[model samples]
Target: MKILQIINSLDTGGAEKLILETIPLFNKRNVQTDLAVLNGFDYPFLKILKKLNCCSIFSLGNKSVYNPFLIFKIRPLLKNYDIVHVHIFPSLYWVALAKMLSFSKVKLVYTEHSTSNNRRKRFIFKILDKFIYSFYSKIITISPEVDTNIKAHLKYNNDKFVLVQNGINLDTIKNEKPISKKELLPNLENDSYILTQVSSFRYPKDQKTVIKSLKKLNDNVVLVLIGDGPLRNECEVLVEELNLSKRVFFLGIRMDVINILKASDIIILSSHHEGLSLSSVEGMASEKPFIASDAPGLGDIVRNAGILFPINDDSSLAKEISKLLENSEHYQETVTKCLKRANDYSIDKTITKEINLYKSLLEK
Candidate 1:
């Protein structure tokens, strides 16, 4: 079946990376797949998509589904593609709009990568995740929590949502040697304990919590905040307020996350909520234990692999950090558990399951 994956921008993020990884899987199965990037196509992941024979269509789809010209633009393309799969929310807006305008019968699939509790995103684009989602051919979520969370949005008997947990490519990260901490930052050496987090500084993926948690750390651990977003300056300001300038390292948008994960001693995630964080998954794959918030999606994955603290509790987070640092036995135990659990998120498993899902959906 010819498939068209719709996305807002082919930028770097969990959703972007996940979509990029899926294109090859479709190609391997001889499925003709193309992409609909709602904006610019210059992202590194999008560049790779072009190489994979995925056609890029610049969509006028924006934050709202009211992009009147989008349907006119996308309607013509739907004549050939059999399916239109949307990744993320705003893109879903366009897919839903385009499906309404399509002259041909194209299967509409929407994947919910994050929970709808996103305050900032919701303020402007309140996700119409109501029963209208039932209009789609199939619904997919990245974690069980997301599937469970849908109950609050839809009435009973909305249909069973497919739970496709985020997958990790062990082969991609395993054998590669880690970039030494000194080489990447060119400052700290063996004396530094690099505690890193990969996240776009957004309200839900609470980078401020991590910055706050850093201030309470008993040790002189280096805090590395990777990835960029609106909250970058806010996090920096918090670091300054706490006088953590020397300790906090704000390295925005590093593509080589696995290499950094490998080099770091510990990873930290203080997201107020999540839908299966790709960064934490990569950290587990890299055998680095993390200190993540006890929120949905993330809490389930980091259960045994890392220490969990209350979402908004700085004291509890500080206590957990101290526990990990002081207790060598527990630290090693968490690491061992994390490494073993990482295998559960293997790329082969994710790819195989997704292909099966696609085939099943197509057959119906």
Candidate 2:
């Protein structure tokens, strides 16, 4: 079967990472999977995927991802594939429009990656979303929270929605060699503990809470923020305003995230909500006490396996970190549980389910 995975520019995000990791496995299974990007910008993920050369890559245009012109650009490409799977916003809308405009019968599948978005907040957008979502043959939700939220927002009840939780390659993270503390934090003391949060600085992510919680922790604990976005500058200003410039490090986008996660003393994902964050799974698989906000998409995965702090509650987050630091046995036990939990969302299982879904769509 031929599958075309479409998205906006593959910058830094969970959906981008999912495409990067899964295309190769799909090809290995003898499925011809190709990728098409609406905005063919030279982002880090795009550069890395180009290097792998695992599948054919198509760039519709270098214009804005939301440009209405993308609909025309993508419409022609739809005829070449049996299934066109889309990810993220504008791309989702554009691909759906392309399918409608071209009258293409190719099955369209969209993966809803988050529990909430700005589009759902407005009445006009609710109308627009309902019309846009109707074009897809199947809609995949990366988490149960995502599934529930989108269903309620669209006010539709049908078998069109499928729950396929997001996953990561656990073994790759577990086996990755850690970057030494001295190299990761050159100025910090050798004995210092590092609290790392690997997420793009975005609206749904609560990096501010993580940064604020750093102030309540011991001086030896430092914060490392990875991945960059529009809110990154705001976060940097917060760190400075909080007089935490010395303790917080903004590492931007790094290709070697697994190594950094393995090296860190603790892994955290302070988000307002999530659709089963891959970083949460990666953190747990790192064998560190994975701490996250007790929000919808995140709480479901982290409650029994790792630590959950109140959403946007920095004080509670600091207390949780303190508890883990104060007791070695508890810390070790949490790590063991987290690593065991990570096993449930393996990429292998996700791939098998996805391939089966593709087959079923064709059979129908």
Best by TM-score: 2
lDDT for each candidate structure? 0.75, 0.92
| Stretches of model 2 off by over 4 angstroms after superposition | none
Worst 10 residues of 1 by lDDT: 118-127
Tens digit of lDDT per residue, candidate 1, span 148-192?
A: 776555544646477778787778878867887888778675666
Residue by residue across 80-107, what tens digits does model 2's lDDT show? 9999999999998999888998999999
Candidate 1 TM-score versus the reference: 0.90
Model 2 weakest lDDT span, ten residues long: 166-175
Q: The CA-based lDDT of model 1 is what?
A: 0.75
For each candidate, give its TM-score against the true structure.
0.90, 0.98
